[model samples]
Target: MVHYADPSMKYKLSRLNLARTDYLFSRDAAEYATYILNTSPIKANEGRKAHLQLLTKCAAALRDILVFGQACTVHRNIKN
Candidate 1:
């Protein structure tokens, strides 16, 4: 079961029927890939791979924020 330190976010997520934030991050990753493919000089598979990696890092960065970070904590003593 998922435990949330912020009840409001949990409630909002439940209302939206989202079990996890992966969907949002995946969508961002795809859009980032498209953006990189279209505008960046990198081009092709290399560009796509690069952008995917960047977005992965962006999503990982969210794990440090209190709101989003809470979702990833596995230990009771862990604090963002």
Candidate 2:
């Protein structure tokens, strides 16, 4: 019982940490996206593509962060 409880507690803590990390990453990504969009001087087609690529990367990073948060939460719910 103690073993199970310990594991569960650890999982919960991990989940919370992951969620916080995700939130931070998401915030940073959004900021980066804004910066790229605002400062990029991509007027040509290729430049546009590059800008879009940066936006896409930011989106992907945010998505991964969210996924990690979800996984952490799911694991946190498991009974030891």
Candidate 3:
């Protein structure tokens, strides 16, 4: 079972369906990494490989978020 040091941490459903009960702010990528790491040992080799693949996907998602933010900023600058 998973345990947390904070008794009152907010819980939310991660993309992997695991309980994420830490962090005051909403950090999607961090939560995804946490879930993957936390569940890495469930099926030994297969689980680890799956987590690695998930990490790759997470990296891509973060990159997309960054690119979108930059695009919005550029658009705002041009509109002014």
TM-score of each: 0.28, 0.38, 0.20
> TM-score for model 2?
0.38
- Tens digits of per-residue lDDT for model 3 on 6-72? 6545253243244333343358778888998886676435534545457675334444444433433
For every candidate in turn, the CA RMSD to the true structure comes to 16.0, 15.4, 14.9
Our tally of clashes for model 2 stands at 0
Question: lDDT of candidate 2?
Answer: 0.69
The candidate that achieves the highest lDDT relative to the unseen native structure: 2
Name the candidate that leads on TM-score: 2
In model 3, how many backbone clashes occur?
A: 0
Clashing pairs in 2: none
lDDT of 3 at 55: 67
The model with the greater TM-score, 1 or 2, is 2
Q: Comparing candidate 2 with candidate 3, which one achieves the higher TM-score?
A: 2
Q: Global lDDT for candidate 3?
A: 0.54
Q: Tell me how far the alpha carbon of residue 52 in candidate 1 is from the true structure, in angstroms, after superposition.
A: 21
Candidates in order have lDDT scores of: 0.67, 0.69, 0.54
Lowest lDDT sum, 10 consecutive residues, model 3, at 12-21
